[model samples]
Target: MPAGKSQYRKGEYPTFEDYSIYAQRVVLNGEFVQHSHDFDEIVLILSGTGEHLVGQRVYSLKRGDVFVIKGETRHGFRGAENLELVNVMYDPRILLSGEGDLRAVAGFAYLFLVQPAIAQQEEYPYAVFLDEDATETASTLCGFLIRQLEDCAGQYQVAVQYGFKTLAAYLANHYRTREDLSEKLGIFTRAVQYLQYNAARPIKLQEVAEAAAVSQRHLERVFFEVCGLSPMAYLLELRLRHASLLLRGTSKTVAEIAGECGFEDPSYFARVFKRKYGAPPNQCRNAKAL
Candidate 1:
């Protein structure tokens, strides 16, 4: 570990009881020591220039640069010249679990999942650079999100969640239109989106590769290198996550949820669910009920 690497806990930040979104604007004149946090962060550079060190890689930062830093990734900034940025830290497990519609957008998966996953492996992680107009718009959205967090008025949580989602969707949509996205990354993003769209059905590695116009072997290698999981394992995780959401939010039977989440056998689903969540579906649902 690097010297001065600090750990930032989510509990240390002010967040709503029901929502975990936190936003703050930071201005740095000198070095910010290396640190890792317990929540995902969306960084939007507002002004000036700096050097960002992520893991063992260093990248230059400037105005309009946007990227994500996943939880527990050690990163810091140095050689700062009035570097200004908005850091939107969030708990994806709480925010993304219920937003199935966002998953339908391929850019969402690419921006939040694929880009962060490949950052350590690739020379430069993919980032979306906003133009002057878009930068202004994003700054306004971040300001609104920060105000919502501060005010704590009635229905403020709702506004905060919606505000975060709006910022996320706007960035994802912008990324989708960028001409600089590499062909290989495009293939990977397509494969992830296909899996997201078809996770409720029985699918195979070959099918996923075909959807992405790549060979099964190649796809497996890419998934492992970028996502740290085999394609099949990733799909299983998606299915289980969906099943967990259904278990908590719906009155569906375990068998129904199992089937709906692409588990062909209820017994097998129960075993896998127990292994992953440390509880069977019914027990999980009952606990949620109470």
Candidate 2:
């Protein structure tokens, strides 16, 4: 937080530290030179639609969508007509480690914590306006994080830190970590939430319908349209996906993972696992492929 005098006019000097949170309206056709930041980015689309160009790929974002740009993910946006958003950037360390500066981890964080997929040729998933409960909670958390960072109130640092944990958890839960077919890649965020929460259950089309408050037929039509998969098939794939995550992230036995992922028969679970992942339970667990 260093203060410096501006080149023009009346005596004026300001330190970035004096400003805890930075909020502004980024108008369309605005050219923001490519820049990188040490803190994380939480971008909330207030209205209209826009495209985020990170390198060559263009991510179409719509109103009510909130995107988390982890660290130095080399991102900038172009707003469409009538576009508005709240872009929150805060010292990532303040929200994560709480007490110290992340001078040491800045570079590494940029690679893993910030843009984990950039080098791997993967694109960060876009969390469009979907799922009322999750998106609303995220928006509230983001608002507070930005406020506390901008204000630097008493103990706001600690509060901001905790708020980030909530934000991170929500991101991981709401967005699927995959390419090709992904829940995170869809527009109906509520359906994704329902699929995530009830992935292991014997999912019914009507239930998916009810959870999203859309009729089964309507849900199927749009789910297929946006996701390229039927609602029920999407649910099955999600179960397998959760199981796949457990396969690598934990030491859960096949049977435990099977039941945990809603499959009653371990034998049947192994069959589905092999079919979906091209490997049996033991091999998958051994290889630790998620």
Using TM-score as the measure, which candidate wins? 1
The residue pairs in collision within model 2 are: 20-149, 20-150, 21-149, 21-150, 71-114, 131-190
- Per-model TM-score, in order, reads 0.78, 0.46
> Candidate 2 lDDT, tens digit per residue, 169-215?
55455542223333432324456566655656677777667766767
Worst 10 residues of 2 by lDDT: 6-15
Q: Candidate 1 has what TM-score? A: 0.78
What C-alpha lDDT do the candidate models reach, one value each?
Answer: 0.78, 0.55
The weakest ten consecutive residues by lDDT in model 1 span 92-101
RMSD of each: 4.6, 13.7
| True-structure RMSD for candidate 1 | 4.6
- Tell me the lDDT of model 1 at 3: 30
